[model samples]
Each structure stands twice: as structure tokens, then as C-alpha cells.
Target: MHELVSWGRVRLLGEAGVQAGNDATTPAVKITVLGSGYVGLVAAAGFADAGHQVQCIDIDVARVEKLRRGEVPFFEPGLREVMSRAIRGGRLTFGTEINAGHRASEVYFIAVGTPPLADGSADVSAVYAAAKTIREVAEAPAVVGIKSTVPVGTCDAVQAIVDEGARVPLRVASIPEFLKEGTALADFMKPDRIILGVADGEAERVLRDLYRPLQLSSERILVMDRCSSELSKYAANAMLASRISFMNELSRLCDAIGADIHAIRRAVGSDRRIGPQFLYAGPGFGGSCFPKDVSALAYQARQAGVPLEVVEAAGRANEAQRVYVRDRALSMLGGEVAGKVVAVWGVAFKAETDDVRETPALPLIRALVEKGAEVHIHDPEAADNFVRSYGLPVRCFENEYEAATGADLLVVMTEWRHLRNPDFPRLRTLMRTPNLFDARNIWTTFELGKSGFRYLGVGTRST
Candidate 1:
């Protein structure tokens, strides 16, 4: 695979086991990944791919065994092969125990998930639990790297957790990932920026030495205080999520008036100011990061006596976007939702990821089922997860057309790589009627015109 060789130069890139030149990087630390879920596994695999002596630790033995066998438990495009090669080559090792890992590792990265809670805050119990384990067994003076998307005071909280029971000083730093799930390896090796929040003396040199590869490439590595680093990650996601919500609001406007959003987007993007990224309208934003991180930030902000009105508004807008798409689908089907056969193209939150934690398709599927529609769904990697979660109220299709066969309508939820281009001839044959719902507005109105399908795109005005 291209991924295997592409990452061979990885030891020359980011902060795992980067090559050294100037008076540093002598005796690079043993990097350890704590957790084996999407973020944890990917981070672990990437560092191992980077030629670092990486030991991946998780509580789940099945997950660990899967990694050890080169069979990735999830569907990340380049992850499986790369992890497999590394595991085969003895650069990467997987274990279920945490204490042995802590004793052996020099840089312990905590990449566990921070699922949301009822109190509208991030439940960071997993992170604290990991720290408690590290405190009990670690023999080495380690820099605890937090690669998780945590709340603002999280690194500080982790520091307190470790320090409270720790015999030696357990330094904690935030190195939050900006990776889109499927493209994690690419993002990790060639990131736009690398964030490091550390206290002045002890951890700085270790961090600087570790990240010499990125410095060579001249990528911006922002070195800030630990708290700022933690907040920066949530703030970054909030801004991106807000942009999606903002455009979805405009999408509704485009539907109302006789305005094509594609034209407007082109016109607006032509200016140097707005740059046309995250500008497309969709069936609301979903996936693992946006909803959880934004809500977590909002909660943290409220606790600090400053409610994030704008961010909270964006979250509400994203939720409404899903409702808007469902209503539009119902409206296009002449407002009678019962006995409707709706074929949905993509089920994962966003393309290139199997993660459907808060995917729009899940909500829309639930709505379609409630309204008595026979929902047929298709996704590259999310089908199994969807089936496991929802338990087959909707039919899972092997191919896109199979899902579309005899359907009254089609809803394109996630913008998968292949779904951007479709076989209109086959699509027409499969459908009961020629109604298409373009939630991502991927297909042009001109293309739809030539195809002779009654199209309902998210932002574009109906001609």
C-alpha cells in the first residue's frame, strides 16, 4: 500500500521519534498510547509508523488482540495496513495492562474518549482513571501527553490527579489532535500545526527534541501554556462547527427564495476573505468531534461563569439542520410521510470515517422510521456500527443502488469520496420515483437537469 511507504519518512516528520540534527534528539523517549479506540489506536499506530518504539495499551483485550494481528478493529483507510506492517516489524506492541506500559514508557499519551454527560459536561473519568494507573506503576519520569479532545482545565486536572498520588513528578501536557478520523495518518504526519502546552523547564526540551521533524518542515508548532492549548482545540472545533451551522442557516434561506447557493458560494469564495472551506450545507454536522467538543466547551464555559452564547447557538443550529433536511424530504414527498421508501446514500457522520456517534443519518433514520418509511441505508464502513446501534429497523444495503431500489426518495447524508460521482442511469432504474435529496449539495443542479431527476438539494434553490 502507498500508505506503508508514505509513512516510512515519518520518522522525519512530527513529535514521535523524529530524526535529530542540532544538539538534540539523542535518546528519544519510549512513546506509549493509552486507549485503543479511534483516536487512541490511530495515534498509537501513527507514532509507531513514525519509527517510534510504541507500546499501545488498552483495557479491551479483544481490541488489543485485533491490533496485534494487523486486523484493525475499525475502518480507517490507511490505518490497518500501516499498523499491521509496524506490528509485524516489532516497532509496535499492544497490551491490555496499563501498569507495565507506564513503567516502560517515557511519553505516555492519553487518547481516551470524553463522552458527554447529563449535566452537559464531558465525562473525563477515563482520563483520570488512566492517570491513577500511571501513578501506581510508572518508574520513569514521564511527560504524559494528552492526545484526547479534553475540556479546558483537563491537562491541569490530569496533572493534579497524577501528582496527588504520584511518588515522582508526573508532568502532563496537552497535544490535542486536529485529525479528521479517516485521514488521521496524513493529518498526523503533515499537520497544519502542532500544539504543545507545557510548563517551562522540564517538559519543553523533551517536546522540542521530539518535534524536530516538524520544525524541519517549517510547520507552525504553537507552544502555549497548558490551559490555552486545551481551550484552543475546543475553540477550533467550535469555530468549524459554527461555520457549518451558519451555512446551513443560509441553505434554508436559499430554499425559501429563488437563490442558488452554489452560485452564491462561488461568488463569495472568489473574494479572498471567506475562502470557501466548511461552506457547504448538509443534513447538519455530526461525527465524533463537533457535537461532543462544542457541548463540552459550552459546559466548561458556563462553569467558569461565562456562557458561550455563540457556540451554544451553533450547536442548536446544527441540531435544527437535521430536522430541516427531514422536513424537506417529507415536503418533497407531498407531505405524506407514511409508506415512503427513502434511500439514504451515506450513514457515517462525515466521509472517511466509520464513526457515527452523532451522525445526521442516525437522527434522520430514526425520524424516517417513526414516520413509517422503509429506510434503506448504505455506507463504506458504518453499516455494521449502524446495524449494531439501531438494530435493523432500516435495511442495510451492500451497494448504493440496492438501497435505492424501488425507493420513493433518496437522501445523501454523508459526502463519501465515491458518492460524489454516481451512476445516474442505475439510480433511475432503482428508484420508485425520480426524487433525490442532496443534503450535501454535491451534485450540481445542471447535472440533475441532464439526469432528469426531481432534485431537492440542501442549499440550492429549486428551478
Candidate 2:
């Protein structure tokens, strides 16, 4: 965790009486969020739930219609319920554009996507478009908060766009989001730190008022410049990704030297300086944030005549880790996977969400299919998304046991809650070869050899 301290124009909340700008006594501010994607929708619903009137805008007409009918396009654990409740309270609404109805909004959040381009730079076209839209539709002096994860100086660039031909004073600020996919709503409602990247005191005050509800129990706000705020999101994600890649590299060393990576991890994480978090050694780190952010940061660094070697290496290590899992599975099967029945237990990168953007399972499954292996997959929530996105030639099973039936090998990818424990006896009876490749190390606690099965786990002694 980054230290919450006062440094170089960065101040903690309440320092120098800054908390007086916004407090519990102030009424909830009207908010309009541009883009109804994961971050946008969650922010809209969370702000509404906090008693603020919020209007979520999107360019996708069909998605807007669905949201208007209380339908969420994606699968987040508690978002639908919160959104539904907010809609019922009349505090949350959805639309395709920022029309006259949203003119009274005091804060506008640009929550659009900043997808990676071919060279790994963030494609902030959506963010720019949202700024132009705000400039055209916004009626009053509103604080334009950026909730999108963008490269450094993006907020400044957006400021230039919004400042042109603007009828009102639209202040652009970087309020980048750090919400995780599985626990986005909780992360939003109780954020670790609310970053306020503002150029002027008015922008800070208005955003502080907008986010005042989340800061009831304690002060969790960090005030800084827009560039630093934009860079902080990428820097945080890159550091976490580097930790995961470092653990993965250690896991491979453990595999080669007949040592337990878990034991080493326990000792390493015991140190107070390195508290245990993001230290789990799995197939590899994957998702929308880590990989993209690391790559984008590296790209941005290179553009500035500097290079982030650690961030670059982290990206390479993740790809190598995925290949390592794939190669290990094939080598265990006597270096031949052709015509073998392989069951993949989990498809999502991690648990509790249906997002599979850069899941390690993608490359592994693709390699399996390319090697002529019959791949069967089962995930509690991500099967449909995996199928629709990859279009891989694999059997999708509704049940984990069903997916394992008649399988020569079972490879566990994501650490879904239910996948942690399984009927070993039933699996032994169902599998043709009874070989279990625990890529996630979720079954390391169980002695599978006693169940008459050959078990192989990452960084664990093969049985």
C-alpha cells in the first residue's frame, strides 16, 4: 500500500483544513457518468445508492435500453442488485446521451474505456469523445472527473478538449478508478483512497462533495496533480503485476529444485514490509487491468525516452508463465496430447466474475486445441463468456464433475470457490487416466495420491 502522506503538492484529506470543502452536512450532488461500462455503471449505482442523483450515459443504444430496464450487460456479483435498488429509488437512471434531463448535474465522470492499441498505448479516443460530449451538453460549471485508467497527461489533454468552445467552466480532473472486477461495488463504496487530481480548488471541492459519502468513517482522500493521479493507477497495477510475475518466476525455480513455493511464499510474506497480498503463485496474472496497464506504462515510458525494464519484464514473464503451464501439461502426458481428453476446471482469470480478457486459460486452451487435444471446460460463471469470446472448439460443461468425466487430465486454472474442494473419489472414478494438473495450486492442501490419482501442482512435488 502506498503511504498516505503529504509530499510535493500531494496532501492527505483534512490537511490544512481541506476536509472543510466537503463534509457530511452537504447535500448529495447530481452526477452524470459518461459510458455505462463496468466502471461507469458501478460508479453511477454506487453514487446513487449514496443518495446522489446519477444519470449513466452510453453510446450503445441497446445497452442503454437494457440498463434503463434495470438490466446489467455484464456479470458483477452485487452490481445488479445495487443498480436495481438505485433505480427503484429514482436516484439512478440510464440514457444514450446527456440531454436536458442531465443538465443540472454538478459532476460529470468520464468512465469510458481506454483500451490498448496495437503498440500497447491506451486508445483514449473514447475519453476525448466523452470530453467533447460534455463540453456540448454540460450547462453549468461542472467538475469533469476522469474515472478511466489512462496514461499520464491524458487528463491534461482532456482539459484542452473540454476547454475549447465550452459554454460553462468544465474543469477536468483525474479521479482514476481502482476497482477490481470481482469486488468493484465494495471497492467503490469503501475505497482505500479517493484520489483527487485537480488543477484548481473548485474542481477539488466539487469532487470532494460528490464523493463525500464514501468518506464518512475516515478520511481516505489523496489530493495531487492530474498527471500524477493518472500515472498512479498504472504504477500501482504495474507494481502488483511485477509481484505476481516474481512469484511465478520463483514457482518455476521451486519446480526445478524440488522445493515448495508455498513454503517460501509463507516466509517471504511474513515480513511486515511485504504483507501477504498478490503473492499467490498461479498460472499467471491476467485480467483487464494488470497486463494492459503494465504494457501501457512501458509504452508511455519508452515514448518519453525512458524505459520501464521491470514492467516490461513482468509482461514477458506472464506470457512465459502461461506457456510453462501449457508445456508442463503436455510433458506430463508423455509430450503427446493428441486425442487426449483434457478437462479445464476454470476459465476466468480469477474468481467471481465473467471477465476473460487476458486470462492465462486462453493461451493454454488454445495450445491444447492446437495440439489435437479434446478440451472440456467448466466454470461457475465464465463459460459463456469464454465460449463467445474465444470461439474455441471445446466442450462446455455445466458441472465441474461432468467436465471431468472421462477426462485423461484435469487442469485447474482459476481459483473459484467451489473448485477449491472436489470429490476426489468421484474424480478418480470418472477420469480415464486420473491425472490432475493443479495449475492454480488450489488442491495443494489435499493428498491426491491417497485417492489413487497422479497429481501435479505448480511448484509442488509431483505425485
Q: Which stretches of candidate 2 lie above 4 Å from their native place?
A: 1-24
Off by more than 4 A, model 1: 1-25, 99-102
- Candidate 2 local lDDT, 67-86, one digit each (tens): 98898898899899999988
Quickly count the clashes in candidate 2.
0
lDDT per residue, candidate 1, 345-383, as tens digits?
888888888877888887778877888989889997898
True-structure RMSD, every candidate:
6.1, 6.2
Pairs that clash in candidate 2 = none
Q: Which ten residues in a row have the lowest lDDT in candidate 1?
A: 1-10
Clashing pairs for model 1 are none
Q: Give the TM-score of candidate 2.
A: 0.94
Model 2 sits at a Cα RMSD from the real structure of 6.2
